[model samples]
Target: MKTGVEKLTDVMAHFLGHTAIRLPDDVIAKLEELRDKEDHPLAKVIYRTMFRNQRLAEELQRPSCQDTGVSQYWVRCGTAFPYINELEDLLREATIQATFETPLRHNSVETFDEYNTGKNVGKGTPTVWWDIIPHSDQCEIYTYLSGGGCSLPGCATVLMPGEGYEGIVKFVMDRMTSYGLNACPPLLIGIGVGTSVETAALNSKKALMRPVDSHSDNPRAAKMEKLLEDGINALGLGPQGMGGHYSVMGVHIENTARHPSVIGCALNVGCWSHRRGHIIFDKDLNFTTDTHSHFVYEEK
Candidate 1:
């Protein structure tokens, strides 16, 4: 029988070996809506590229983006869970192998040497965020493949306390005007507002993992979501920075109370093919797998 660690390793290897979750119906609907409204020929071309990429990824069983991104994991750990040792290494190894087998574009760069790891693992590769909960024996892990083109446009700023909500909107607006096109229009935009830069940046990344077009539970944040979504769509960035009726696929805002003097906020955007998936495993290794373009039960 496979131990929990072996089970974990198996899943990770399998996940990296395949593309997760097909674009859901709503996502496909939104893309269709944009395609019909898109006006610029170039923008239309970009949209076509995205569509074609998705098809090829499915047909060929390959990643849509060569830059499979810096693999990021948001892990919720159960206190009662066993086999904690070597989890990180297993993840790193999975990424290394996936990079080779899947041929994920070599994205890791050595800052000082300017050399690509080509293997996708380096000093601190495959960033993992942990949330340890009360007594339990199950864990849920969300995996995200954040591409460079989309992540490059991420923005953060600390607004003065007096500026209030309006400042946040302006910051987002300015970022879009400057780099939204390059990040890929019709993007999934995540906004985080909190006490410091780090919190804001982290929350911003978390926001992208949320279901496309879902709003935050906080009433105020939900309102901001609607406002930002409307404002961005008005930009008509269409797909791929071409002009259209919609510039963003969705807008998610995550927030936390900040110090009285600080109004820190950050923005992260995901391109049309925003790649992510979630899996939950029980103590016996019974798990709900929601990656590789399907929802199924898996066991190792």
Candidate 2:
């Protein structure tokens, strides 16, 4: 007889294993669309290889990238949930299980010790960001499997108050020119502008959660989205940086009014595959699962 806590751990572990390797359907569609538009021969070849590799990964149920990534969970836990007491521990145990079950490449390295967790159970493995709300008994979770290659070039900077909005554009353009190619092109760009460095950085990552090609709610931000998209695509970094029709699949910007004295900004990039997904669990444990921007799976 399994306890609710045990069951929860197992369920999360299973889904993490499956989701970590699968590219969301929308991401797949965007890649295919780009493959058709690319004119450079080598870029085209890389695109085709990417598609075939995706298929092989799915068929074999193996990870699309060997670096199964540092598992990160964005959890919206209902305050009234029955197992609230153990949620954090459950998540950690699930990560440990998934690391080996998925045979996830051990990616968590202890900073001072510089040793791999070997089980993905280091100090902050499967970093979970929790949101607690009232009057609900269920949790809505988004698991983002972010690879280091894509995350390595993430940046944040504070502009002087006079830098104004255009300054953001210049920063993004400059960074992309220097390191964008390293992130595996056709990247999804997440820009965050807020009053503090940490908040801006987090908002930037949240921006990637928006659907591919989606625009900001504010009209001015929407315009910036277009400007950034056009500028990045013009770079011709293309697929795998070989050069072609599109370098960025899309750009999403998130912002908040800043302090009069400071301008905070951050940028995080997601590779072509952008592995992330959502699962909403009801009080009874029934759920609906959606895979990233593209893949969808239903459980009966």
Candidate 3:
């Protein structure tokens, strides 16, 4: 009989491997929507090529993007979850397994030592962010493959209070104008505003886990999401920056109260093939996910 650790490890490894090869359902849907809306022949052609790539990636059972990226996990677990203590290590082990099985590129190198770990799990690779629940018996995991290209232009900064919300808009637009093309476009932009740069940065990434069509509960932030989406699309960085009618898939904003003195802002961008997955497991290890359509796990 498989232990809970072993079973969960197998499931997570499968999910990680699946994430590499498949674009999530929402991502594919959004891509299709963009492709249908394109008037530029070049942009349409590029979008078709992208869909072709996705089909072949599945048929060939290989990653859609070579940079399978460092595995990052957002674990929202309950205090009453049976295996909470082992969750982090299970994620690490699963990442190692997926690296070799999914044939992910070795992207983890020690910062100071500058040596690639090869296994995709270095000292702090496969980063795990935790959200602890009070007394529930289930956990939800968000898996993201953060490729170097998409992560390259990520940045955070503090704006003087005088700058106001307009300053936040300028910061995002400035970043997009400067290096947005570096990340493959029709991008998903995550914006975070909070008390400090660190919080903003973290929340910016977390914003990426939100559904593409969803918006913040806060009405002002929701308005910002629509406004930024429209503004970025106006940049016309469509279809790998070849230029077209749209520059982004969506813009999501997350914010918290900050001091009177400064406003912290951060931006994270997800490329056209935003590789992310979500799964939930009950105490008995029964699980469900809709991120990857028609996914079936074959234990080997």
Clashing pairs in 3: none
Q: What is the TM-score of each candidate against the true structure?
A: 0.91, 0.94, 0.98
The order of the candidates by TM-score, greatest first, is 3, 2, 1
Whole-model alpha-carbon lDDT for candidate 2? 0.84
Candidate 2's residue-wise lDDT over 1-300, tens digit each?
Answer: 567787778878878887777777678778888889888888899998998988898788888888787888888889887787788889889888888877788988999999987888788777888889799999988888888878977999999989988889999999899999888889999999998888899889888877786799999999999999999999989988888879988999998888988889999999987887777777666667755433333332
Per-residue lDDT of 44-158 in model 1, one digit per residue for the tens? Answer: 7877887887888778877776667888788887888774456678888878877777667777888899999888788787888888877988888777777888988898888
Candidate 2: segments with Cα more than 4 A from true spot: 292-300
Kindly provide the TM-score of model 1 when superposed on the true structure, using C-alpha atoms: 0.91
Q: Between prediction 1 and prediction 3, which has the larger lDDT?
A: 3
The candidate maximizing lDDT is: 3
Alpha carbon RMSD to native, model 3: 0.9
Order the numbered candidates by lDDT, best leading. Answer: 3, 2, 1
For model 3, the superposed segments whose C-alpha errors exceed 4 Å read: none
Residue 39: error of model 3 in Å? Answer: 0.7
- List the global CA lDDT of all models: 0.79, 0.84, 0.92
